[model samples]
Target: MESGLAGWVQTIGYIGIFAVVFAETGLLVGFALPGDSLLITVGILGAAGKLQLFPAITALFIGSFLGNNLGYWLGRWAGPGLQRRVRADHLERTQLFMRRFGALSLLVGPFIPIVRALVPFVCGTLRMPYGRFLPLTLLGSLIWTVGLTLFSYWVGSKIPNLEKYVYLILLVGISAGVVPAAIRFFRRRSARSVEM
Candidate 1:
């Protein structure tokens, strides 16, 4: 718990938690927020008796789920218009990718940063049936909220000096998301170059 982060978490409290989680899942601008770090901090605070676990988890779950849904709806409403302006082939690739890997993407999205926000939007843009999309989003939200929150709480309680290592944890968690995306990007670029 770096004092800066700790102080921010403490100062903002639960509303801050809800807002951040919601924005991270729903809004494009939210990709830059430190959602994983914030969740872990919330967990540590819960362990320290600063915030109650049930309410915190509830807020996080609702925020994350609704946020994803909102993004989906936004995509349904706005994505087609946007897609019309872009290359048709790019749009096809997006839909094709979603068709092939939609479930996996939904299940894994919340763990990633920008991708988390993009997943639902892309799914809706691709017109993935709502039936197929909802369950996976729910499962992902549960894991992202309950799983990570509880894990951090457990670690905070067990570790002697947990504060010192939080920044490292944040970096690792973020990297888990970013590194894969980076690899995919480079691979795609290399493939295109080879084609040329």
Candidate 2:
């Protein structure tokens, strides 16, 4: 699965990567896409000189920033009707996340998969000022894009023939990205069941 995904990334190149990032961040259906894993693969490839590091990073940032902007607008356009269609618990949790973190959720959301996809839209429905959303979104995009890409690139550069182990690396990245969220969801469900 990892090799196949990496191959797809390589086949798609910069524009494809941009589109994936945009959809993942902007579109509701994009939550299932492999955003983190793709970045790790891209960084590794860039280090291997199969892809250009700077261009890959730029694509990531642009896609994320624009995608988030689109999501916010979509939320505004769709309003509460869209929120009503979402699972009640998911909507509640996202609202809780926004309340708990305030503006910092924008910074943190980029690191979390489902939350990253939903935060901007939630912000829009809640009518968060665009002036405020823009800068935080920009900063979040920059940090996530640069931090992940450069770290993976450095790892790729230091380890000879790192591409051979790219699948393993992606497995770990996927696990790292997903496990905690799964655990949290289950724990919350268990707690709710116990309360009942």
Candidate 3:
């Protein structure tokens, strides 16, 4: 799955990067897509003279911003109905988190693959004011896309095994996101048990 996606991006170049990032963040089915890996690969390619770094990063920033906006609207349209039928505990947790730290979540969510895709939708469903959401979303998108792209570009420039290590970087990135969420989940569960 990883290599195939990388190959496709390699074949299509910057446009592919923009599309994949857009889809992964904007669309639900895109949750499984290799976003972090793709970004790293593109950065490596930029370093290799295969792609233009400036334009590619620019497109990535725009694509992510637009994708999150689309997701937010999509959530507004469909999230309410889905939220009603979903389990209550999950809903309560999401709502509580959103209420307490929505801006921070919006700012940081893009770096975490799963949360990247879902945060915009949830914010929309909860009717978060767009005025507040937009600035944070833009800032987060800028940081995640530009920061990773530049980091990978630097690594690719310095490393010989760009392809081999891109996956490792992605593994660390994914783990970074998952570990925190898992810790939170366990803490929440323990608190509930104590209350009981």
Candidate 4:
């Protein structure tokens, strides 16, 4: 069942991968998509010779960068009106993340799932200078796309018949990306309750 699922993912090809990455990073509706797992799977496929490594990496990077730009502009266009529509707690958390991290948040955001999608929009709403946002976002996208892809590729290449364990790899990748966010959320909730 797992191999079959991985096979299906491989069959989607580069364009499908690109679309997933683009929507996951750009659109608010994409929050639930498995961006990290997809990237790792792409890397493993590349190692298994099921996909071209260079083009896959290129497509992933382009999709992420462009998607972030789309989110930024959308936020800019919607302005404060968008903020009102968003859950107040989510907006507040995003704002606090930006405030605590400043510009570094753009670079780090790609590693955090929901934050990856929201930070650019928040920056846009705040009118972060394009000159600054562009390069940082570009760097972040590159680091995220290339780093995960290559690491997974390397692992696939090293392990004999690693493709058989794709599900395990995916589980690890998803956990790595999600566990920290969950911890942070629970901690924050506890802290808030203490205050109240």
Candidate 5:
């Protein structure tokens, strides 16, 4: 989970923001591209006068928008093919999430980490229409990017020393992200043990 590219990307300004956001949200190969880190890093850079907040936000917003659309297409084309080859955990989660969220899941899924990587595939498998998926997904990406970016900017302004403790903050952010899933996992484990 060490992000080697994060340092390089942080230095390149808007292009960096677009590339990272695009890959993380749209390409499965990019799930490790540091979505949260991008937000915080940009904010810190902005505070340090290396980047401007509005430009950073705009680039990320567009990147996120385009990436999700591309993901939906990849999902649509590759989804069923992948599903037919797997009858294991992937299939189970695929069915479960699809059953629960339907096509709208594509719109919500990009915000959810591991789930973010799978939504486009699910959308493809379900043959969800592109027109239906585009607007909502874009809206969601804008909100997610701007909100997190602004939050990071705000925190950076107050601290102004994020570069020194960025890793610590990332660790804390990661823990915060994992807590709910961890709680649910533990609860499931406990219930299973009790049943046995």
Candidate 6:
């Protein structure tokens, strides 16, 4: 994911941070996006004197916190009716999974791509209380945001010439993220075309 946006990642500054972190926590599609990497990238840039690590980290933390909160509320309000109408067996699966893994899912869901968004929605649909999720949400956000931010700074600093060609690294990161999916998408499309 960072490969795709490595160059732009460092140069684009706060805008990138806002987009990645917010999408990661708030949007279901963002599960695949590189919130962790972006933070690390930001830190790396800061360590190299290209960007400020503190502000980047702060923005990331706030973005993550708000994103999760928004997602949680969206799910809480969205509920089973939304699920039923949007019905696919996916919702049923969400319900079943929640019965067994609701707490764990809430804690760990943010790490996964598709599941992250769905889990929170499931929690809301299943009526998991906000009191139960509030602390957990904050904890998860901290773990994800701060931990990665520091790691990126440490790692970025150690690497040779990472800052020299930030764009290439960003491209590599984004390519790493989308290439597999693109391959899959094309394969599926080709398969469908053949069928027709």
Question: TM-score: which candidate is best?
Answer: 2
Q: Residue 94 CA error for candidate 1 (Å)?
A: 7.5
Candidate 3's residue-wise lDDT over 1-196, tens digit each?
A: 2354455666776677788788987875455787777778778877866678898899888889988998888888898776565456645655565677757988777776566777888888878899988998999899989999899899888977565555667678778878998999999999999999
Q: Candidate 1: give the clashing pairs.
A: 1-163
TM-score of each: 0.79, 0.89, 0.77, 0.87, 0.81, 0.68
Candidate 3 error regions (>4 Å): 1-5, 82-100, 172-196
Query: 1-196 in candidate 1: lDDT tens per residue?
Result: 2476766887776778888888988765455787778889878777777678888889899989998898888788898775565456544554565567657888876776566767787887777789988998999899999999999999888875575566777778778867897999999999999999
Q: Rank by TM-score, descending?
A: 2, 4, 5, 1, 3, 6
After superposition, candidate 4 runs with Cα above 4 Å error: 1-5, 176-196
For model 6, residues 159-181, the per-residue Cα lDDT tens digits are 86576665566578668868997
Candidate 6 deviates by what RMSD? 5.8
lDDT of all the models against the reference? 0.78, 0.86, 0.78, 0.85, 0.72, 0.69
Backbone clash pairs for candidate 3 read none
Task: Name the top lDDT candidate.
Answer: 2
lDDT of 4 by residue, 25-107 (tens): 88765567878888888888888887789999999999999999998998989968767766777677778888999999998
- What does the lDDT read for residue 19 in candidate 6? 69
The collision pairs in model 2 are none
Task: Give the Å shift of residue 165 in candidate 3.
Answer: 3.7
lDDT value, residue 187 of candidate 3? 100
What's the ranking of the predictions by lDDT, best on top? 2, 4, 1, 3, 5, 6
Cα deviation at 30, candidate 2, in Å, is 2.3
Q: Name the 10 consecutive residues with the lowest summed lDDT in model 3.
A: 1-10
Model 1 weakest lDDT span, ten residues long: 85-94
